[model samples]
Target: MRWPRHVASLLLTAVLLVGPPILLVRLVGWPSIDSPQVALWQWVRDPLTEQNLILLLVGLAWLLWAFVAYFVTAATATRVWAGVRWLRRLPLPTPWQATATGMAGAAALTIATPTAPTPDASHPGTTTTTGTDHDIVEQADTADGVALSGGWLPYEVAEQVTAAAGLVWLRRRRAYRPTRPHRHSQDAQDLAPLPSTVAAIQAATGSRPPPPVSAPAAGLPPIGFPPTGVGLTGPGALDAARGLLITALLATLRQNTVELVITRRAVDILLGPAAPHLRPGAGLRIVDTAAHATALPADARPSLSHGAEGGRRVLILDEPPRSSLANSGATMVVLTAWPHATTWYVEAGGHTRTSDTANAGPRVCVLDTVATTDLLTVTGHLQPPAPDTPTQPQPQPQVRVPRPTAPHHDTIRPDKRVLVRVLGEPALLVDGAALTVRRTAARQALVFLAVHPDGVDSHLMAEALWPGLPGQRLTGRLYTTLSELRTAARTAGLPIIDRTGDRYRLHPDHVDVDLWYFHRAVDRAAAILADPSTAWQAVVDAYAGDLAAGHAWAWLDPHRESTRRHVLYAYAALAAAAPDPRQALAYLQDGIRVDPYNADLHHRAASILTSLGEHIAAADLTDRYTRRLATAGLTAEGALIRGGT
Candidate 1:
């Protein structure tokens, strides 16, 4: 019942071809293979031409042949009709079988029969030509024109010959060249020659060097943003938004560190034209977020409008002000919803309700690509707390700052240490130990280096992490933090090599950053797959652990996607490169599990199953893939309805 459409189509076609012949035999009688001569003679002879005894035998033979053919046709036709009906229940090319059959027949005819040239007016005795008029005339010959082809030619041939001759006749008889009208030299010369003498002053002026050119004024920028009020305007905003969203979706490349997301609709709208350039291996994770059918906010209906631009950064869409909608939390809400992997949280009546309860972490920032303009209005300037703002200490707290009793070197040790600080705080982990970081200035200094990783400039670092601190004071703080961090590392038996001119780098072997591990695995897999023989072992070992457990930082999604993609790629390569079908299927199955949404993966799995003669499994996988796609909101482009059936 769940037979593939192709299989059903084949059965239907076989029935159509075999049924007609059998039915004709049953209704009119066909010659039997066993008694060929008698059957043939009886079939050809007129109904009235036989004796009574012969007629009775012929009638009996005819009846028998009719029964045989009828039974065969009826049985096959009934089975095939049912198959075709079943095929029509799916959303696929159900009737394409008929078209395919027609095409096949046409192709067979074309290949089987050799083409012959059409009869020429001059020659009048060849076959059909698939050439043009000029060619026909050029190739025709009076010598080849023998008796007018047994009888009259088909009407088409006659017309072709007549048309060719007419075209040739027209070519020979046509001519429309323009005549040159005579011009009087006396009248023409006097009117045109206003003199070489007048060129005297012009020559003197032309001999002088041209004045130095001045730079032209810059013109106004083009109407850069999309007129639809989508935040697609700016110098590179459109390009940036696309890259950002794509990167976010495909965070596997970035290990999911970048926080950006887009809706399926957004992907479709932006990527439809550029679909050809979309690389499947680029480690993009574009998930369908169209499942949310929730209504818009109560007070803020999303009205598309533009905002003022901030240099080359902002994309403003100009629109008439909606006074009622102004100042509502529309902008933040919209931007947050713009991304697929997004959820919201609200605190009301002393309780917090979160939309993303399934997600393990709390939400930090929301990026709304919708008509929400709140973010566009937020000025990035950080103003100091008001002068009269009194910072209140916790009511129950009376604390003294803990002073280090041990030497600076001993106090900075790392051992089974857990260092917690703000994102930019300086917390060091040496081996398996953690170092106590001086809160604030010293902690931030360490974090700046960790985040930058490539080594920040000492001057720039001083200015940025400790903005208002004076030169000597800030440098002293930086040194103190560096000392404590180094001491902690040494105590924990870790490596921290200081470089000349105030530079530092973490030892690659000692520090196991997740980002580094992800890249190593991906790179190794890619390398081996490229050569197959070179880095095979490394590739396998690298992808052993996922973005280290419990470390699904929002920023690491891209990296996660990247790592997952490489794993799949490695598996696929292994499958393809393997000589054994069993091994190939194993690898393909693993890849499928990791990247279930990949169409090519499904195709590969199905192919491997089919190759292994697991037809049922192959069919089932295909059905599963089709259903999965339908669930993702992609409707079939065509209906699979059997035409004749």
Candidate 2:
């Protein structure tokens, strides 16, 4: 297939070399040499007579012909041999030579046949072209019609055909060959019971605990390295730590053989089983240990309290008969680990077979006992309020109080709702009233409540408002701010506070918060979709506006955009629910207007247009959508959307 032109070139060279030699030898009528000696052969010569001159010329011609024949034969043989070698393995020519050869061939071809039919006319169905330099049309004349033929193939047509066929075949093959299903089987012999050769069996006729349930043995090797990039320590270590805990559970469930590579401190803690005790007046006391082993020393037993004054609860771990208490168990969990060196955990237990293997250390950090315990203790008992006694009623003084023109009350009840507005650059109307709290601290306090929208306690409020002040001052400042915010809320009618000891939180529903509406809209939308036929109208109603529009909250952008997209989808869904084709098309158009680039919108529009008897519009939209996706560099995926056309 390669060097096809070489066949023609070598043939031409052979013809040129061989033509004269054969003609000369025949014309000269040269006598064949019979002499065996080289000297005699060389001495033999042609007679130089005038008549012989003509014969000499003819002889010369024959000689030349013979030489040409020899050259042509040699060239032909060499070409054939070269081609055979090339067929076995080709050596690509240097780039320059390749380019030059292509140029020469193209030039030669151009000179021989200067132009091809750019405008195909031969076979109209088979000949289609895009960019062309010339045009041609073939026609057959008849009374009824003109039949066209001799159309030229576009340059890229062959390539496109081959690629398309390959792609089609690939897809067909994939469809024909579905994914393999999983199969698992175990032989009876492979499920033989474990050998007890080296185990320390007890001599006494004691009932052995039930053999642990058979488990699927771990099929991984052990290494002193990390697991899946999960470190044993850091900010996200809790998940890994949980995995380690789960590993302990798995060990118990799988009845895996385990080994401990714990630190000395952990060994010390495990050596003694500690129990918590409750005392009469002193509350709870934690005691060191209790010994349940029958083989325990008498002196040790007497000193160790079985039951003391405090409420006693004891934990006992009994060693297996003839088995070291430390190692024999269903779950062999390791507690301690060295800070520097890595340790491994292995599981070996199964119904069909047995093997020993270890995986790299858990991608989790060992718990720091001291630090963890201290943190837990410190966060446990934060007192919210101090005990106070009720004051006696004082009703002796009946001073005349000037009533407001609108008849104001002296005190606002705690349970009543009061509006509290925010005063700012844009001026927010919170709880359906204008904000009166002008101080930054007061505004900030209200902002914190609005930001939390759930509830915030007194401690956090104090932290937010008077973070730099001392504890008592901060507490005092928080009380003043709370009083001001409460008064403002009372004037505006909003639920200002719901107290629990000293903590307070906002009542989200009691006030008209923007977030409340947004969430309500989202929930309403979900409810509508839950039953589309009955709730479609409600879903459309809930999309009031962009979330917190004109508000400077960058964090809400993704949520806002997500809501916008859902709104568009809601429109599409409504389009589907329309009672008539006209209404459906209208809704589909509205959806496209909202989300022009959304493929689903375009698809829905196209489908609606098609149903409404608008073929051109439907086809145009479909084509536009396909082109849009193709321009975005998703041609393969676009082809799929085009139904593999």
Where model 1 places Cα greater than 4 Å from the true spot, the runs are: 1-491, 496-504, 509-534, 622-645
lDDT for residue 261 in candidate 2, whole number 0-100: 23
Q: Write the per-residue lDDT of candidate 1 for residues 211-319, one digit (tens) a residue.
A: 2222221221111111122222222223234323322222222122222223445444444433222322222223344222112222221121232231111111112
TM-score of 2: 0.26
Candidate RMSDs in order: 40.2, 37.9
Models 1 onward score TM values of 0.28, 0.26
lDDT of 1: 0.37
Tens-digit lDDT track of model 2 for 1-645? 758898998777766676555555576555454554753444455345465467557657667766777776797799999999988797778999999999999888877563653322221122212222111111112111112111111112212222222232222221221111111111222112111100001000011111122222142212112211111222322222322322222222122221112222332343221101111111111222212222332223221234222111111221111222322111222222222322233221100111122322222212222222211111121111223412211111221111112112222223334433321232334433466665445655655564344465788667544322235656767777777767766655555555667766655335434333333443444444354643434434555555444432212222334444545656766676678877877876776664445555665567667667788878887777667545532232442233212
Q: Which candidate's TM-score is highest?
A: 1
